[model samples]
Target chain A: MTSTSLNNTVPAPQSTPSYADIQSIVANDFEVMDKQVFGSLNSKVQLVMSVSQHVINAGGKRMRPLITLLCARMFDDNPSEKAMHLAAITEMLHTATLVHDDVIDESGQRRGKPTANATWDNATAVLVGDYLIARAFNLLVGFQSLPLLQVFSDGTCDIAEGEVLQLQHQHNPAATEEDYLRIIDGKTSRLFMMATQGAAILQDKTEYMTALGDFGQHFGNAFQIIDDVLDYSGDSEVMGKNLGDDLAEGKPTLPTIKALELLKDSDTEGYEQLRIAVQTGKTPNAEQLIELVRSSGSLAYCKQRALEETKLAQDALSTLPDNRYRTGLYQLTELASARLV
Target chain B: MTSTSLNNTVPAPQSTPSYADIQSIVANDFEVMDKQVFGSLNSKVQLVMSVSQHVINAGGKRMRPLITLLCARMFDDNPSEKAMHLAAITEMLHTATLVHDDVIDESGQRRGKPTANATWDNATAVLVGDYLIARAFNLLVGFQSLPLLQVFSDGTCDIAEGEVLQLQHQHNPAATEEDYLRIIDGKTSRLFMMATQGAAILQDKTEYMTALGDFGQHFGNAFQIIDDVLDYSGDSEVMGKNLGDDLAEGKPTLPTIKALELLKDSDTEGYEQLRIAVQTGKTPNAEQLIELVRSSGSLAYCKQRALEETKLAQDALSTLPDNRYRTGLYQLTELASARLV
Candidate 1:
């Protein structure tokens, strides 16, 4: 765990680490944070417990909290228990957003598991999501750090705004790349920035904040772009979701926006088809639309963009202290970019 | 504004003041707080602005903020702009809860106006409601008072728990009067408590915190009780909702719970009818069910309970320094109870 051992154990930049590789570095902290995520649900209401535990348990790769844990250790080797608690709060907030998102999407399953909305009902999901959000803030107040509260509160507003903005742009083929970036920055990257920057604030490593925020934001953007690309190109069985689920929902992700842009001049028929699909959310030609987007050279363009963002994210991390934890963070961005490949 | 003037202007307990009469006392402050409730929604996202403004406009009474403003002035007549801001934040939180509640209840019209969920969609309403909650917390963090944040955050958790608890007891004929009280205490009274107690915290009037909280809790209980009573007894035109709406939704409010308790032994046929209504929420005998609840004497019992709660709330004001603001608060409680009469 010492700096020397960390440096010797760290891999060179050429090889990307798996998520497990990064997590192994902070295995103990992850265990405690994982427990705290459920332990924090002290609601006397049984339904709250059942729905909250279901959603939290159904959560995807605790990446946000993992980032928080890594960043906390990147500053001080032996960070306080507050770091683990804050990490748990981040996961709780993430879970709350997911529960609400499932309700909004009216999705029956996520990550191959039934959603809270599906398992219980919309009312149950919404209220339990609310309980998680409230409890997260309730615990954040326990930290008694106004600066921490400010970062989180502000970020939460941005997150909500981002989700709403995406809804606004839904079915609009004219949505620009800038709009896509703005949406992802809010809905995805903002929490990442909070996770890393929050660690700096909690550890009194304020000097590292700007760098950490940059790392989080760029990585978040890259992560989301990869996710969008995967929606068009990844294995449907592996994703546990059909291809173009976003398009079916009329979501204007970067791939769709970029495809529309690239197709407008050269292929009017293709442009009209995809544009109308985005507009009406009716995919009579689902396979053709997927093929149209893939054939439009937009996926390649998106992969290039994802790589650039990943690079920027890694570059931002170069400013932080060179340590095992920092290496773990660097590997995380690489792992995310690897998804693009 | 002074104690002497307050005593002279105060009406006898026998006559209750209307909400408007109480509001007129803080007319200027109320105006500014009303503007702030809209002004605080400074979301750059156009959709967010639209939905937030729509819901806030559809909001009823602005009672919570009024409580906040009154409590603020009661402690310090020259309360800071932060007080107005806090009052607005309280209203925002209240609106957020209502928006989510509408979604949970699948309500179409509230107060004779189309709800955000009805106008936009459940997705939009859920996200915008979330935005309001986040923005409220963002503003609360601006106060830089950990104690204030503590009060609001804790109260928020209680509110969510209460809502979930209500959901837990839904469609259960056996839901008790105690369960009903607990549900209202969390769902309705907690915010009222926060409204008054938050004002005390911001104004550094810690000594009045207990009294303000007690006033808020009891008043909240009374307000909800009257609301439930009205669901069965009040004019649909005045209430802007149907009689037996609670029973239709399978919500076991105080009136229904009490009615079932009262009819279980004395009127077996009435008891089974009402019990089936609550359990099934299939009110084919809607009129008969309403009649059964009415004849069971539960509305009168609920009304008496409401009166007792109102008296307790007014009595809590006795410890605070008597002034016009205090009188305004006392009259507010009386007005709530007058709904029963």
Candidate 2:
């Protein structure tokens, strides 16, 4: 178990705990919520179960569900099991989006594991993705809480719209930072907000709804911006996807969008090269383009923007009750900004 | 407007009405419901709107909503606008499924119009289909009825499961009638049941739930069976796809499942040819195989099954009121059987 185990012998925090520290604080919830994720996939169809299990098992950090758990504890120390179940449902919804995103991205792997589309066919992946979505809603209805269903359903619509909006902007270099924000807001951040807001709704702590919403939205923005930045500059092995992937797909994330803007003013020839690459999605000179974005100083501007958003997210945490769970959320934003380094 | 308009003169049917006649019986509800289908696609993304509108416009006869409207009117002569809204959501969910289905089938056209996947790419189609689904649940939440949400969510899971189950059985020549029934129940009839049962719930007619379910399941079974049978024998010009499309995809529908069963006992050479064709999805001698199924009399057996299902659906209508609406439901089943002839 090492020093990281979520056991009875807990140490007092000297400072903001690490992301792993936040995870261990909620480790028991995380452990049970992880099982709930797989347990929720109770499809009678064997293929549905297997494919859903595959994608959920190829789990991301379960960050969205973690937000739910932290928010639940923030409101009241010993929250009901609904929050864990809702956290699982949040992750299930996130998994559904990832499965479809992989199909849309035509991705072979995620987090160094073969994606559902790669393991099975697109047809199976698409349908299983659908099952995950339906099952998520099915489980949400079990709470008998219309308010929870409301936020999740509304957020889900935004998620899909964000994805479609991103596709609409694909291969179009005219996309702006505003457009990039809108894209991430839907494709990435909506679920994050849902994660926190869902906990508030579940815990009957609706008074914290606004603060949780702000925290979720800002943190989500910061998290997604960092992720997009990582796509350009981070270690591909650690990221589980190659750098310049967004560029290869012609996705004009903030970094790319800013780089295009910065290059438009400073270097005319460089601007055309990047613009043509973005417009065409033909990245034959991939290394040069990656170098161009890295050298163009847009990453610096994006890093600044990410920090600003993180500060905003952390500020939102101040209005909520002060506890380790809130500290966990604050450290989460810090950890997100750390990825920028 | 001719005698067909829903303006006023909904004539009394002396016998089972025509499909169009039954359609005219609920023409007012159908008109509003049809608009609601397009109206419900409130996506902010232009691409989402365009693709969603494109597919919903290329709609079938709105039969599922028709069933809902009929069920609503049978319970109360004048149903609420909620029923109309619910009916529209039904079609929206149905459209979402069709969009995904086109992507899975790699279909070029549906109802002689370019499908979303054909007009846009699979990524756009898949995501837009996702938007349609999310939007459906989002709208369903407006009803504020837990029971309504329960049925729709559960049915959606079943619908996706059916699709996955069909995919699981694909290219398996050993698939049987039992397997085919299970697949169609999940894929085809589950939504049909939701359509009927959703109306009963909206109209506060829970007492009629079982009968409505039976009507939906049997009619869905009959509708799908006839459609699959048409793949073998119907006119390609009207159906808008080539004959043996399912066989080409290695989809073992009832005709194929039963034909494989019948051929094994009577004609060994014919059986091997059909079996290999299904197993490998290499339908080189397509006409020869189609004729082999026809000669095997699987269509005759399938038609009989369709009639029996149609009968069960009509018998379910008898448990509800005996108004023009119930009459409309009865004639819908009859019209479905007529396609067999």
Candidate 3:
């Protein structure tokens, strides 16, 4: 769709591949992982099945599982069924988090579709989310590999802690960049790290764990930073969420945090206004605040930082064998960064 | 405390022990398990630690962990530190469920203490509940026993499914007694079974798993049935909740289900009133509804049924080695049944 360099070091691609193009690299594996996500849900309870299916079906891109699938193949070309199953588990865990996040955010819609909490009551959403988590662990135990269990269980805890850390920082306008990184690292990157390293662990490619983990973490950081940037700059119609939704929710994302820092010295009035908005979650001047952040040059800094993280992620991949799957992953980071342009 | 027969077959004790008295049989184990419940929470996230501590401290009876401690000793007189850790994990899982339950139920207080959802927001409660579940599994993985992971994971899935099943049956007056058993079996009994069987698994005493599982399931059934009975008969102040709270929530527990059946024949007018109340959850004449169920002889039947389950639980214990811990577990069931009188 568009041409961009995969990284500053790599030559510019003739054309940037779309997500579908990247997914097609592992087309058969992607299809199986997608099916297993729904197939693995074996709940005797009718409500559990219905709610779990609704949320999982509403999922976006399947990026985390794609990462898992790609990483599994990078280690072993003919990865076993366990790799596909593990990939499905990653998506299930992701869906579980989204289900609870909707309940927490009191969101009615996600990606133009109604949320589980919106379709059912909060009670159904919460319990079904719990069921998904339990079911994921139950399926993981079927592998009988303690190492696999250890990676997943430990990653899940970090994901939860990351979510809690985000809550702790909510409404605190003074939240620093370090605080933001810690929160996203726990909530966002940890799962990505798990997705990458999990395959290595499953394939008994323990030696590749560190490189895979670094690839995951840096890629995750880039992904979340790009997402935060889009919250300020992307089209509401395209994104299916309003601009400044994070600010209105008092979530101190990078744009708002950096904007606050940039405005503090240059425009004290603008600084106080944004700070109050963050503190009270009162976005009466939502349009004006968006403009202020845009004019403050914060988005440029955020894009630059996202690009830096993307570069580091691609660097980490250099240690692994060069293959189509690695190129797919490289293109993924570029695609995520392309959103910034 | 009131005295009750331990079972129809066993000779009645001179005096039935209270829960505290039964817990005193393994007082040292109970103390360590209690401390470890707090100590095992090693989250760097301040919010996680605070909310986890709040719910754990507000825990009622620590009965599940007590069951675990007692079962551990039944196999090995000198259980290792792992037993205490496992027992603590049981409590953590129990607390995790309670935290989410509060959010689902929108409960303001539990056992006279403010709930995590009530004290913090639902977001914080949901995330921390997740953290606890993950932390429990993470700790379980540390044991490096796939069998232990299998039992805990299976039981956790059942617990969540049971919760969803209860939500499905809510406000449905047509729910049958069988449906009630299935619901409580998942939501209540599964954890009890896990606590008992987990100890046997950890101690390498697979021979006793079936008996221990039966003991835990029946005991959990009796405990839940007795709890339902008390919702109609216990003191509001003493129970820390209003009488007929379950009816208010439109939960068709055994009392409500059985009463609907009995009243349909004895008094058609009374049957319609109860049915409407269950359907609408509009219990304006709450006392009258309580009276209608009481006069229909459902409470007596419930108490009789609870006694039957308690007897079955004691019968399961016949296969296990006779020891003070066995006596302690038997007394624990007696203590639960005593609440009925």
Candidate 4:
């Protein structure tokens, strides 16, 4: 629910550069960052390490860390390992949220992998998630940057608040697009903002903070929006996604929120069915509800919104620097937007 | 399990001081600290506020923060408000752990109050708990003391690891008393250390840290031992505590661990019943098992160990200022040990 399933699995886009291409732009940094994500998890408790390593192994894309790597390179080609370390912290934080999200959603599997909750139990998942978050801050404090700690700590609060906000709106049919924006703003975009802005703070590139924030926020919004739209229209069978998982969880994502808005007057019975599905979370009519959302021109609206966010993200990046790293960020947004087409 | 039920309930002793008596020594700081605990919770999300306030409202005697206030005043009769602020943060961290503990335990009530998990649900409980944790760190960072942040971040990691250690040892009949000590050291005593040491750090009383640490550790150990001892021998019928709840949950507390050791050679059948109960977390013969542990002289041994720890805590206080605050600290340990009598 807190972008737990928002894996950076960019769908087919013949024109845009791929995720691997962007990651390769900072391939060396990514290698170090990937190792540090595992290395930084120093826990005497075997269960903490085992569960953390398992989840980090299955962690999707390392997308946020890659953003940090790219941003660091954008500022200084030979930025200190601090950027890589910070990138790793961002991934750890993201993984922590995902672990808790699985517990909350009672999700057995995520992105074709069994979740920590499935492998162990909700209690293990919850505690391990807590360890990851605590360890992240512990490592962040080692950097001796008050600003770094401030942003990370504040971002963490936003992430939790965003998650709670999503919970508040769960099973709520009246949740608005504004409410959806606010939710993603915290749960999803806030970390993305941290990934880039953290690198800026580390490299003494404080001047670029605002632009990096915009880039991270809009890009995050685009990524999450694309993921939510896929919950309805993606090749769920091939992806192994139980279609309408979000709706079944009564997660009033943008697709559901917008569909309810578009269909409020056009098709009262269809609207009523979708509304009840969200409110009750008894998605006996899951297929029909998904189809109703898909046909209500809601997916089109969401796709367009995702593109607008992508464009805004690219525009924000243009204000940062002109480099292969910046281009990589642009392509990353294009890759996210590519999923819709 | 992670000291979630260590409610700091000081049992009867006419000579030893009462909890209210010790708290009254720092009554002003306690009042300010209490308000800060509620005031510092500034989540804009209504649910975060609602759940956080509910849990904070239900938070027990706030034993840890009282340690902080006393430590601060012992160093400086009028220490800065930072001490009070840090005290509040400790309580916040404690409440956060309790909220998650309820979720992990699937507990409906804790200390005779409906838990956040029971009042709302696990999802809300979990995310709100996360928010409380993040919020605590967020406020801690406001202190601008890197060392303070370092200790807190490190303490938080230890807390989580302690909890995971508890979960790992759960349902294991082979768990040792040493393992029990390590579990409580992290889950229960670590925060106590933080409560005392954090105030010393704030007051620039660097010399007192070692003594404060010793005091916190021993007092915490004594407090937790008394609580576990009560599980087997306390008036469960009147206290609303279900006897053998720890055994039913397969928690390897000192009483169960010691009982297992004591009866293994002396009473094989009784030992096997306790062993099976621990391993399976099923106590069909709960009353008999509680009686066995009680009669095996395990509680007496535990009570003796608790008194020894209480003496060590009082000894630690002798190195610090010998004001009423120090007496408050000494009396606090005496009150805890008095429960054993």
Candidate 5:
């Protein structure tokens, strides 16, 4: 439509394109795919269709589905209709979970606007999310790859499990890094892995399938760490949600957990204060605690770990043959760990 | 051990197998297989194992998983270890969804006991449910059948979808039998279908797998109808929960919908009162309305349809080779629909 779009579509982004550049390519696919998926949601039942449309039209970044498309394109030039269908499905699954998460969190806002739960009742939010998921399965059945279905299904289970695991770990200072990893693996990385691996399954690329799975796993962990860190340090307006909502809810995100572990021995007063805050669900002074973590270098420590995971993600990509999209995926790892707001 | 225990290498009910006989038989395998699958949960993390155990021990009827186990034993002489593992996974998945359901439903009690949300917190309830689902996948991986995993995974998605769909239909008097069927299929039948078909997948019987799926679909529909009827007619103590909780929650159960449809012309005053009660979540003397439905033959009408489904369930068994467990499964379907209390 625009000159820049024409230029990019003609030659594609260069090898190892920047995050913005990659997003531009994905934007095109996202728009087309969304229309296709949601369009098919039309039904004879007006309420079912209307409610489904309201939920679907809410808009998402479609990052997970983008990864799926990028990975499929990276491994092979000739992608099938199944790859596109699976890509759509990946987004649908992700979106379905988001609506349910809103209900579970009881949050009033998401993506800078009222969440489905907040706009409608929790009942509609629940049903719309369900319709999206069923529609996803109905679409995935088109792929006809039993293994792909298995992988995606397993990922969904992992996502649910991860959310549940995190729920149990809340307000408990004893929550370990291992527990944190398990939670992220289930909640975050599992879907990332499914998205990429599902692409591989569709492409029938065995060798790259495992590698893509690893890439998604590491990248998802890195992405979640950045999200946790941003929760503590970033601007609420830019991030599109309240800062420290997780902490207020008594969730032990990476920064808080690591900071608590660091201060366990020396700063008894600080540690006890933080523990009391978690129990009472009132951070005595939110900004002061944020500043303390910043000064203590725990945020920096988490950032470094996130960067290391980025390296692991890049290393996982080495199994695939050289291609522009592959290199773009490698750069995506770095972009994920980078601070945006 | 008692003489009855010696006869089965397992504990038998003191009152003998009666109302929930087939369910009890299935529950035995469920407990054993869950312990086996969750053994890994203990090796890695002691805390999650304990928390998960506490949640699992909270007690449920094991309806969905029982259907799976019964279906498995129906087709084959001795169900495979994979079948047992899948059965556990199915129950865990059901439990995971239930815990989340309480949070969404804001339910104070489940099965006549305080809900996880009431006992701990919404966050904890959410996390524990997630943990159960995660443990389910961990268990599922042992079977390593992608098709099997896919079926269960799709089931999970459907479960979530069904919950959402039912939420959308809440308090909408116009919600049709078709709408209710779609909701229950996602909520109730999807898992039931998965349970039976998952077992069939393990047995490598494609033809019977389809038949078993249909059997679960019909039986599940019938089971949910009975459950809805119990909400109106059954004693709270015997049913293990309050009789009118569904009405209080504004859930448009089948009997209520049917009752509303039948009473449209003559009982305008009563209907308006019913509508107000649902809106305010207050029970405004349900005796008259309940009696009206009882006399008008809607309950009996629903019961008749349930009986028809049971016949369909029994007819499905003809597709598979005859076995004692198969006959037991048929009996279980009749029991599910025929029970008054």
Candidate 6:
């Protein structure tokens, strides 16, 4: 049940730059750019900035920002200074959404640590989230692109709508695959789309920009589905996450939903019991539940879908000229789907 | 100890139609305009619109949007369809702040009714607030003014920082007036400045736009100070709010902060008791405290400052051309200051 083969493969996914690879190219830039964007949090809003940076520094992949920078680097020889700013901004936006998400979920923990809301109270967390988001726009507006502003704003709206849709389905056992897809697209992928598309916009890659947006969107879907799958399949340390967090929150994630659909009437009662346990926020020793999902091929089903999305993401790269960076982006999609396998 | 004379003479101070009066001319226009702005909430994002309308209809004064529309009407004969859209956007941004404020305060009620957070849940309320803010930008980006987006974005950042300032001071008895003033200016007046200035930008009134922003900021400070006074000195019903709601939340409103500063050593016990009451979030018998504040003339002190700000607001208007709407704006400054007389 604990797939050693899958665990081994996660470290060498085809599409993703290994953490070391990303670091070699952009780590110092990430630090400097983040300081510039967040340094705007000065004497007046220092409290907000201090608390927010503390939260951000805790641990996050910086994947969104990296994707943005890589997308720009792919198109332009020496991507303008605006690329760094946009990269920092997309990360800020993503961070803001996470803080707000913690508040929405009433979550005390995130990424295996105490969330800002848990440590500083909901008011501080909420305000800090707002501050980060406002700062993101502040950085973006410095570039003076109405089209850029429009794209990011539309993305934020989609994110908010996705959050609300997820809220409506809390503890709802009947949450559909379609609903899950839309929610993840809005909540996670839209930001990914904005990040990639914003970079393309900066590079003046008008035609490729739209394609990059699609790529990010599809990659994001695959990324999130794998995340959901890992909620069942991942190691606490390896994933930097606690398993069953989604189920504990009654998230009705794809594997759980699919497993529920696949159950026989007699088995359905047992599944309902597990669902009840999830809804009530009791994990109920769900090893057998994981086995049920794996045995029923529900996990495989999700993997298949994730692979399809990864294909779509890779196909989006065809719009761009051949380059190492483009190949790197193509590899990210392969890496995302490979996580499930 | 109530100033019966000031209360009696309240309506004697202003003879002109205030900004509210000018704004009323286009109140229905705002309704139509809001519909058009929010109508963009597509089928996928309709949840954002429905919940947003619920919160909007929950009864706010529509002050910011009215300022926006009146400013546009004053500066130009044709304020562009874009201006109307931006006006609606301003109102939405203001409403988003209020909803988030209610969530942060954990106030079950707002505007004499249950808040969106209380009526639904914090999650719904938070997402809805984000949606509105995003929607405001979505509307503004259509006008294709990078400068306008910059203004709105900066105001929002200031607002977020201001809220954080207030959060840091909550329940801290030593919070100074300077701290209080800075917070209020950022949280409240900045948006008001942006609202008027954004309108002026549309009319291409560069000099007058800066003046209008100054006018709006000063007037907004006066308006909020008066509102704080009313929170203490006026009828809960007539003011259409819960009396001492600020006290219950331990908010260091003008009256309470002043009252606390004036306390003597023997009054230390009483002050501590009041502080405990504020911190514990219990409904104190505010009658004695109200009398104490009255005797100290803190209410009068705050009102004098309000009027001073109103004068500053009026003087700023001199920089603008003589227009009927501008006259109405000047009258509105007096109306804001006179609210708690």
Regions more than 4 Å wrong, model 1: A1-10, A13-15, B1-9
lDDT of 4 by residue, A304-341 (tens): 99989987887787666676787787778888888887
Model 5 lDDT per residue over A113-191, tens place? 7888788776566656655765676566556566776786567666766776776677777777788889898888988
Write down the C-alpha DockQ for each prediction.
0.91, 0.85, 0.91, 0.85, 0.24, 0.68
Local accuracy of candidate 1 as per-residue lDDT tens digits, A115-212: 99999999999999899989999999999999999999999999999999999999888899999999999999999999999999999989888989
What global local distance difference test value does model 3 have?
A: 0.92
Stretches > 4 Å off in candidate 6? A1-17, A264-266, A274-285, B1-20, B24-31, B34-43, B265-272, B275-285
Model 1 iRMS (Å) reads 0.5
Model 2, position A257, has a per-residue lDDT of: 92
Deviation from native of the Cα of residue B155 in model 5, angstroms: 5.4
lDDT for each residue of candidate 1 in B43-100, tens digit (9 for 90 to 100) = 9999999999999998899999999999999888888888889999999999999999
DockQ of candidate 3 against the true complex: 0.91
- As for lDDT, the candidate ahead, 4 or 5, is 4
Q: TM-score of each candidate? A: 0.97, 0.96, 0.97, 0.95, 0.81, 0.91
- Model 2 alpha-carbon drift over 4 Å, by segment: A1-16, B1-16
Q: Please give the lDDT score at residue B188 for candidate 3.
A: 99
Q: List pairs with backbone clashes in candidate 6.
A: A15-A331, A15-A332
Clash pairs, candidate 1, are: none
After TM-score superposition, the amount by which residue A271's alpha carbon in candidate 3 deviates from its true location, in angstroms, is 0.5
lDDT of 2 by residue, A1-341 (tens): 22122211233446545767889988988889999999887777888888888888898899889999999998888988888999999999999999999999999999999999999989988999999999999999999999999999999999999999999999999999899899999998899899999999888889988988888899999999999999989999999999899999988889889999999989999999999988988899998999999999999999999999987787777777767787688778877888877
Model 4 lDDT tens row, B164-234? 99999999999998898899899999999999999988999888889888888899999999999988888
Per residue, candidate 6 scores C-alpha lDDT tens digits across A1-341 of: 12233233234544555555654455556666667555645536667867887787864777888788778878885777788788878888888888998887788877778889888888888888888888787778888887788899888888888988887777877878988998999999999899888987887777876778778899999999888888888777877667777777878888888877776454866677666755675666667666676676678888888888887787777767566666666656665665765
What is the Cα-based TM-score of model 3?
0.97
lDDT of 2 at B250: 94
Off by over 4 Å in 4: A1-14, A237-240, B1-14, B237-240
Among all windows of 10 consecutive residues in model 3 chain A, the one with the lowest summed lDDT is: A1-10
Winner by DockQ between candidate 6 and candidate 4: 4
Model 5 clash pairs are A126-B164, A127-B164, A127-B165, A130-B161, A161-B130, A164-B127, A164-B130
Clashes of 5: 7
lDDT of all predictions: 0.91, 0.89, 0.92, 0.90, 0.71, 0.76
